[model samples]
Target: MLKYKLVSRANPRKRNEKQFYAQLTGVQTIKRCDFLSLLEKRSSMSSADVKSFLDALEFELMHRLANGISIRLGDLGSFRATIRSVGAVNKKDYDQRKYIKGVNVRFRPSAKWMREKSKTGELISFETVGKA
Candidate 1:
């Protein structure tokens, strides 16, 4: 479930007019240990083994993304690196190393995550919990 609140802001051009929008409220967070425990129960692996695997996975993902490679985790999803840059007048004058203003990580969810699982008992259910 998601929680949201109605927020109001004054227009920059017309300060007399106020605009309203929905803002996400407090969201619950889960810890890495929780995932480790879940993996241990779902698979034949121990919590320590799952933790080690996860640690290695994190390191490898960072290493691969730094090298300009996107990773596809099959049913999970894919992760890639992106950059925000200031524009240049000409392509020949553009410098990637200097023009890249910021770097960001992008995650694209898999098909299962992007849609309902049909009759496979895979479905998403959510309810709003009012405001924060």
Candidate 2:
């Protein structure tokens, strides 16, 4: 389970007001090989086969993203290509090389992972790993 600790912080708008918030703690990184092994255990394919498939998936995903295509991975959500750039006053004055800073990939989580609450307090949906 994901672990977290309660941290007390003063409210930005009110210095005297303070509240406790859950903060992630003791986080650990799972390496590629470990991740492949976990996948291998869940599926019939071996870790090497899983790695090969993932490599191909990465290549194809990058190619499609580079071509300005957005991809949706079901419950995991969608990924799209994005660019960071400075605004130009006019189209004629805009220079792609100068105005465009860089290209980046953006990921949006699925609705299942998002928190939802109704005004009437009728329904609320969320996921919690519990406090640390």
Best model number under TM-score? 1
The digit string of per-residue lDDT tens for model 2 on 1-132 reads 446677789988899999877787677999988888898999999778999998998998999999999998876789999999999999999999999999999999777545332333335322345553
**Cα deviation in Å at residue 2, candidate 2?**
4.2
Candidate 1, overall lDDT? 0.82
* Stretches > 4 Å off in candidate 2: 1-27, 113-132
Which digits, one per residue and each the tens of the lDDT, describe model 1 over residues 1-132?
Answer: 455677778888899999876776787888988978988999988888899999999999999999999999987789999989998999999998888898799999889766645334356333444543
Residue-pair clashes, model 2: 0
Model 2 gets an lDDT of: 0.82
User: Which 10 residues in a row give candidate 1 its minimum summed lDDT?
Assistant: 118-127
- Local distance difference test values of all predictions, in order: 0.82, 0.82
